[model samples]
Target chain A: MSRARNIEALKNILIVVLFLTTILLLYFLWENVTMKTFRLSSILPAGSSHSLRAEDVTRPEEIVFSFGAGGVTADPDVDGRYWELWMNAFQKYCGRGELLAEEISRAQFLQLTDYRAVFCRFAYDLPLESFCQQRGISNRGLNQIACVTEMGYSAGSPESVFLYDGRSGRCYRLVSELPAEGFEEIIRAAEQGEYLVYYGAASLFGAESSAVLPLNYSSTLAETPCGAELGGADDAERKAIAEQFFGADFGFVRRIEESQGSLIYMYGYDQKTLTFAADGSMVYREALNGEAGARRDYFEALQDALDFIENYGGWREEQGRHLQLRVRDAYEIESDRQKGYRFVFGVGLEGVPLYGGDGNLLTVEIYGRQVTAYRRCLPDGDLEKWKEDREKEAFSVVGLLSEGYPAIYEALRGEAPPPVPPEGEEAPQEGAFEWVAARLQNARPGLVRDAEREGSLRPAWVLCVDDCDFFYDLYSGEAFGAVPRQKD
Target chain B: MKKVIMALVLVLTLLCGSCFVCAASDPAVTVVNPQGNSTVYADNILISVKVTATRVLKITVFEEKLLNEDGSLSSLDSLEALGQVTAGSLRHVVVSPAETFYSNGNLSFYTKELKGITPGIYKLRVTTLDENGRTQYLQECYVVVRPPSEAKALSFQSEQSGVLSFLQSFLKNIFGN
Candidate 1:
């Protein structure tokens, strides 16, 4: 009986062991499946708007822009006689067009209306609908031209400024926010009685005359005066156009103010802004509440954003003339239990991305499947005109590995300085091929400019080394700048 | 007869002691920093995990998609790849074998300075193994990543209890044994 009881006890232990072994085997299988699924999702797209397929991603084209034009670096040839007449007309409107000649010569005086009409002839190129005013700066009364071209003083594009030449007691104040490159050359030319007429693209280092038009004349010559022919839509028409762009026009009506030739329809109460130019260009901005709803999945938010842009952004899929907008990156925001995604879209001209000096472009914010904010500054120009065919020489990637990158890595690692050995010890040396295996991450073509200084947008090879950026200018073939990576 | 009874009592005592060890000394995995349901303010989060295993440890961070019944993660998707490190990379605590039972220790991972991490929920999954090719512990914790300015200081813990502890508590509750 004792032997039989022992056998029964041993059999019970065997059964328990088998049951536990099966459970353990099943647990492991489930664990592996869960891990595999996690890995697969990372490589896959987050969904429609937040995720991008390999084919859908745009590979930006690389191009280099030359700096100098006609052997002069960003300098324009000025037509002194036309400028003299234009300034005189401007001064006459300010009650001094003919009086300037008393300080110089009477034959040089020109009629204000005739000059305005002539300047308005290139209204498409410059802002010319400005009203003249006299303002005292530094105790000297100067002729102030508020809006001199097609640009608005407030926004849309970078403020396009015409050269301001004002007289302060026998001294001339050549006022320019963007002083052209080779200002010394311009001053020497002006002293010789030759005026420089600047025309073409803005330079990185202020104004360099790309084309020169010398006015070889002794006096301010006045010809036939052309009439001001620009016209704009009424309040109702403006409201209708704004509604078409915004899809939902719900803001309180406010006064329409005209500045720098462009009519801006300001919608108060909600801070919605709508700007329009009778020349068929416009800019619109709207703000929405971002903290009130459950968030949508990635694709849903992306589709909503793209649909909003296509309907109201004045950018059409078929119209190749508008700036081609592409997704630069997407950031997910979770704060205060409020979740959202901010998508930054880059403006591409032809195949090259256009970098605004202010890092300005289109940015859309989506919260809870709805777009909460939209902001963009679409400049009006033929984008194709700026496209370059020949790629210029840029600093080689191999060179970046050895030269600019080592310093950046040292800063990240916090390597200690070598201890001094005796009074005149030699410093320790790094291995010849030390950084050879240090790979660069997230390399791509980006349009970047110096935010602190005035500069034109240029193509740069933006790469991540220790999560910080190293911008290599394609034109200058040098290390442009480094931006420390923003922390979460 | 008295000797036989004594031998029987000794064998029974040995069996009960072995059962106690089986019930109490199992491995456990847990997230230390950014406790479950807590909001992470810093962009580069310092991730710390505690493990009680003798062999290799694999820690993974996944952008969680769904929530399970116990208010934990049900599914996961990878957003960024933070490569693997050794389980013993960082020494955490010094406890005796009798007190810890398993190799109770901690491992920390520092994330790269990420640019625009969408504010959302994420899951950190940790798996550990024993020396004899046996699974030790597998557990996950959920966290919220957000900007510092918008974060709320609220913390709650929801971890998978060790199997031995669960059984102990269950027996104590049911039988008061």
Candidate 2:
């Protein structure tokens, strides 16, 4: 009975072993047949290579206006003039009238006189005495000396007047010219100090000689002696002088209200005190050589100046706070010219901003199907105060949104939103992530396919996951939940 | 009589159990080159066979010869023990066909070089033994040696102007034009 039982046990053991071997073979066969098949046709295609479209992004809502004396010359008929016509045009185009034009021109003329004095000091290097004696002329009289100096000097010559100033140990030359009509008004507004406006060309030797004729506007200088001096004149007399010179053709939109978008005001200088009429036209009296003033215009230009003030000028009181906020765990996106840096606060579902980078508090009001961002500047000392301010503004919580979330979503899923439906029309059923994934899959099917196809082994797909998780899972095969939560 | 019957049955069972145990512990063997019917020269050729198992393995190469008219293996023997493969993780053996010779019906030659062997038919037998000193597997192959002159004639004919050259010229003309 014991031997029979042992034989039966051996048979049973062999049967069980055979069964286990069969199961193992079947599992291997199933894995080889089903999971290992290469699927090459599912790769997506490449996207279009095109320039960025401007209409897709938001633009600033305000305008900036400014006036300055230097830029490219647009007018061709200023009579061998170098800087006057350009300065005049800049002032005119920015809506400062003939008064500002007079101020800029006079200041430029004075600046040219300074140029001519430097030119005279260098004239000795060229044997000017021999040249003058040979030509029966003198460099003493203001008019005659200026004419001789103009003939002796060329723009490209290495001989420059400023170069001789230090060598000669003489005070710098000052040019005489008329001021703009309304100079006093602007000076009073600046409230800095009283300034002098010389009306005759003074040499490095401290001589007030009228011997040299003005290189530009010789006929005008001949008509008015001592040019247009404003010395010993009261404010009323200065105002009258501005009226006489400019003739009441002031051009400006009076009463610029705060509600007309944002206003950017700039202040600048001419040789004389600049005067402005009630209508914001500029004039100068007894103006110095160089024209100096701020220029402003709409949209991007104002934004640029404001951005400069915010970044480099240290004019904005809250700049430090803004900079701190911007540098904190935040990615800063600067403007194309590097003039402005915009901190992306948050993105909404459709890649639209819940609040702009301009520190505007956005409130969404929904009456029907329309959505509008009612923007207002944030209060002091609180960057996140916009959220509370927006909440108090009777805005509706139509959706949970952040300004930069759509970009984050695109980075994760590899696509962005599709075209929005027309008004009163229903949007498509595909969610943003699904749409992006489908687009990526369509572009290169190999990415979503079971196996890689020809020419489709690219590294773009690695961007879909957070960095910490990507490396963690690559080494340990265990997911590290998210990068943002890793430190915690 | 009943006692004798019981003893016979017990002996039969024990024999079957021993066979099962031996089979279970036997090594698995595999023969790699000179597969089935292959060609080989009469000079020395390396005959390699692999024997794998959970434990150690051993291999041996034997050249079998035919009988003489006296019904005995001739003194100029074709059959010989080429070499013994060591019992270890892996073993390889080189058989010298020059030391071996063909007998009445068998052709076997053992040497260290395969250069000067005539054309003939031969057999290679491989035997494997497990670490426990039990025969585990046996493999055999028949190899034919062709004369070197025939191989040279084949190579010369291949190089002569043939259809391959004609087709190559035709393609060059088609593509070049």
Candidate 3:
């Protein structure tokens, strides 16, 4: 009887050992510890081709360095390393910082950024969580905030960073425990640097002046010259870009020239198409024939877009002009009942925008981590002269609109929206500059293709009155072009 | 007591007459743009000024050609005229706050554009007086200018908050509350 019992116990021990071994194997697979060899599929785009990170494409539309007392360095890129240095430092210091005010009133928001600080304004709103993740910032209640349109660090409150939500009009502050070395470096640069200074509209106009947002802007813009950056791109370059899309299967792709002078390269049963237009624009589109897939987050969609652009032709500056793209707009797009996102990027030289065309340099649509559409309209610009001492003339927003109102009024059909008077005040007299003074919804200085002067790029003050955009000569304040605001 | 009261009334009237001769700081007149000492990023500068004055005012911008040909200081006293603004026609209203007091007041807005200027520190002095011909004083402020932004279509940001108040209003012509 004892021998029989011993045999049974041995069997039970073996069974326990086998159960433990099974669990260990399942754990390794679940954690992807052993699947690391297969993880390349997840990181790389389809067909094991292409490389890009979110940081490569994400950039602030413009950076403003406030030196207190209404002194600001907007577009603080004078061919200096300030833009990159400030961007890196702000991210490094504010990541994982504590939240001081989860949300602040508009009054406090304005006050926080009004003083000595470096603020980055984005053309497109960033999902704060995705932003924090991309910047590698983890904790301190940053997740509570939904979106961040602008981020800045105030010298007055050195311990904190302020975030403004342009959409919700909400403000939040994230505090840092350790001293911000990056912020200090920027402060040192602003104090000791020979940067350009612009007065805020608030400083020039009354607080009630609704001329410009953030009220921290100069009405005038520096004038620079630009010519075609990619006007000389030949068929060889276009073919090379197309090859990047089809990879080693270029010979297998069917090429067709459209009646509109655009050459289309179709890959296998219309799975994808690449078009090279006579105007030197290239577009790559994917057929979205699959069923609606689960929508991915904005970060994933953005990453896919970045990877797609990087793989096709490239996103870096073409020619010597540093043609980088910055996010201008993002929206939920649907096709055939399939949900996805469309990201529009404004092309610029050395991080500044190129203001003509469809107002977008690149547009990409992504669904379920797959990019379905990509468009690249590289500027045909010669920016070498602009790289020189570019500030020639400037006109204040009032100056631009004062002389520009008649044309502006006529261009926009004499219905330019006037600034609403403060409550308890009578409406402004229907005549006089009441039509334009301090009523500018926006005033931006940027590079535009001079329609009058062919093959030349001239600086302009792109003023937005109501939803209509009026491009005026930065020096003369003469109307350049006007168009209705493109809906996001 | 009656004689003393009569003498005080006579003194008050005299003081009131003196005040009208010069509006002084009350109902102040201030310069709006090119806040003094401010720097310009561009080689060309426009001495733009936005002034909202209660009385008729003269806006003059003097470019202190502080820099010589060698780019050194030129004794800071040379006031080279950059631009000036004077309106020929302006509307005004007569207001009576206390009995027997009628003042011609106007809330007029004036702005002047600056001319071509290179990178240099300019001490611009602005002199203005109401119809009373009040004496002027000096106030310091700074403002700067930079290149045009017509490069790329900029993403628009049209709402922020409070503005920098009346850029360096050298003399405040406080008309009303």
Candidate 4:
């Protein structure tokens, strides 16, 4: 009886163990399936990529306005004619051309006497007595003297006169210091229109305003020469526009008036800010707030932002404004923590884009259907005249490369020689370089003013190389300034 | 039958407890210390991250600039390359499961206070691949590295007070006045 009972008990135990094992197996299979489904649902959508339609679209032509030319004459002036004579005389004196053998032309002698400053190439051999007798000017025996500019001499002190030896092409400063009395006399003579000829090394070479010397120039000298104030919307006007455009629901708009002649508008709620400049440039920004439905598909987001910019962002059509903007670049961006799309509009006048002043003419940030930020810095001024003037002084690519490259290379490498392409690499031709539509011409044209004179505004061309912008004078082709890319 | 019933109940309980134990060992990634808004106030910032995975993990910290003067989302003035690795090479993958896999491991990053780093928002990311060929990235965490000058001032104040206290204690012990 005990053995039979024990055998039955063992069978019962075996059945219970099998039932538990089966249940565990079912649980494992169910867990695996559920986990797999969860993982798949999470991975598949993220793994698949979508294309942005804005990326496929071609960039539209930018409207470029012509900024007026500088103090260069269409026809050579008297100064220009003399500058040519000096160049010829120097070349002949240095034996690069047929030697004039120290002989002065009757016409050249008279022109020399009219110069407020006189620099003799070989001062010692100058036929000063005869020249002075003819001009009825009292004389000093002029000899192999250096750079002497009668007009620029007062500003460039008489002691600072540089003399270039024609044979060796070496420059030498004549006087360590000029007697204050003598310097004063020279200035008085210059002011009185009397020909003051100083025969030291100071007066050999005449400085041409438009001709830049071989490779000696500073890029820092070029500046937009404080732009003219084209009237801007005041605090009241800005406030009303901000309210009407961004919506009054942005709550309260506070104006932080310009400390440096620029204005800013700060909104209380939604953290929106708008900056308006005296030159009619405006920058607007706002927070994205929520992550939920605020996201839109890439192409949809671009279209929505485009619409917002056209309607509210100062890019709308207006008669006689001549101002237009087109999308130059659009891209889906994943930068730092912010993942969104950005559209850069090339601001143009008529059909040409005005290039200069902090790179982006106008940029719109679109996270989804929401336009999170808008920035426009289009210059507002006499657009028609500026455009017409720029057309006359438009820079050639060849001129920019020839005149601007040396200065740019020197600024980057210091004294080191610039790099040349390797043997098989296609050498960059003078005009072969690319033209990227740029904002902010790196350099502005400004007249070199004396203490009593206000300089004229000169038109400038900004040339970009390896992301560095070099501003060249439209008239002289001298690189007056350089600025690194904003992106850098 | 009575003994068999008792034995079955005991077996079932053991099996259920075993399942709980196995589930407890499932893979996870966790930041162990300085878990939230860690400030650098000393000679260095020490970050301890705990990770549980079936394979090697790629951990990197990146700095993000939140706003610019123009109020744009992207500022070119901000430095772009700020990624730092506390452990493992950029593309390192351990071959053997025995060496690579870990139930949990503490990886400490002693960043020497990240000198010369601009104070801003930063993020920590952990990523790994599972046996199912799925790439899994854990939730990114944000950390703010406070200005070093501010941290240094605080440290200097604390040190000054500590020195004064020590001096006062010494005086008391010597004179008892």
The 0-to-1 C-alpha lDDT of every candidate, in the order given, reads 0.38, 0.25, 0.54, 0.38
Q: Number of backbone collisions per candidate, in order?
A: 29, 63, 48, 33
Which structure among the candidates has the greatest lDDT? 3
- Model 2 agreement with the true structure over B28-80: per-residue lDDT tens digits: 33333343444432242334332222323333333333334555542111111
Chain A of candidate 3 gets a TM-score of 0.70
Model 3 per-residue lDDT tens digits across residues B1-177: 765565555434433332112233322334445544344443333333333233433333333333334645432211111111111121111111111111232223244334344333343333454457653533333333333221122111332222312211111212211
Q: What is the DockQ of each candidate?
A: 0.00, 0.00, 0.07, 0.00
> Which prediction has the highest DockQ against the true structure?
3
**Best candidate, TM-score-wise?**
3
Candidate 1 ranges with C-alpha deviation above 4 Å: A1-251, A255-292, A322-325, A347-351, A378-380, A385-391, A398-440, A445-457, A464-470, A478-488, B1-177
Candidate 4, number of clashes: 33
Preferred candidate (DockQ higher): 1 or 3 = 3
Cα RMSD of predicted structure 2:
47.2
Interface CA RMSD of each prediction in angstroms:
33.7, 47.2, 17.8, 34.5
Model 4 chain B TM at 0.41
What TM-score does candidate 1 get on C-alpha atoms?
0.31
CA shift at A81, candidate 4, in angstroms? 46
| Candidate with the larger TM-score of 1 and 4 | 4
Candidate 2 Cα errors over 4 Å, as ranges: A1-488, B1-28, B50-57, B70-121, B150-152, B155-164, B173-177
